[model samples]
Target: MAKISAFEDLEVWKEAVRIGVEIYRLADLSPLKHDYKSRDQIIGAAISISNNIAEGFEYNNNKVFIKYLHYAKGSAGEVRSQLAILVAAGRVNNEDYEKLKSDLSGLSSKIKSFINYLKAFNQKKK
Candidate 1:
């Protein structure tokens, strides 16, 4: 495999960006748009997933990258939890809710796998 020099090259980062955009669009079209607190919180968490991944990768250390990946994974869970709240509050439709939730779930898994990979690599280096 080729070396990953930029965070943009990461599939998990791409997925996070897609989910972030979807959440933004969802908030714009759904009743969530009218809900300032929920809208902002959901958007923040969605955006954080990608941001953390990029931030960690920039550190250029496997340990640091792993830490950041965990942060990204946590943010994905936050987005999923907020999504559930939005759906329960009737702010988001069932279809969009399901799709975004599934996306976040997959993203979280990917981030976890990446973290494990980094941890193993780091261990081998020691």
Candidate 2:
């Protein structure tokens, strides 16, 4: 197995980065113009997911890292909710909305699992 040294090595972080890129592209294609609140919100949430992961990893403290991971997971949920709103508002197509929603859900699960794994490891160290 490959040794993982940073959050960048995390599969969840990588998926979040991908989701952020897709959100940016979707926002650019949105027909609601610049005044669309959902555009910025979606992008912000998507970016937050990956940003928190990186920030938490840099902290080097398990507790701080886990807190940030929770933030990231929350961000993923935010993104998922925003996507649902966009779909309901007819701002995004069903296919695109579903894709983003599924990806966000997966990211959320991965972050939660990783957090649990970290907690377990920390417990063993105590």
Question: Which lDDT values do the candidates have, in the order given?
Answer: 0.91, 0.87
For model 2, residues 43-63, the per-residue Cα lDDT tens digits are: 888899999999998988989
TM-score of structure candidate 2: 0.93
| TM-score on alpha carbons, each prediction | 0.96, 0.93
lDDT digits (tens) for residues 71-114 of candidate 1: 99999999999889889989999999899988899889888888
Q: What CA RMSD would you report for each candidate? A: 0.9, 1.5
Give the best candidate by lDDT: 1
Which 10 consecutive residues of model 1 have the lowest summed lDDT?
A: 113-122
The parts of candidate 1 lying over 4 Å away from their true place are none
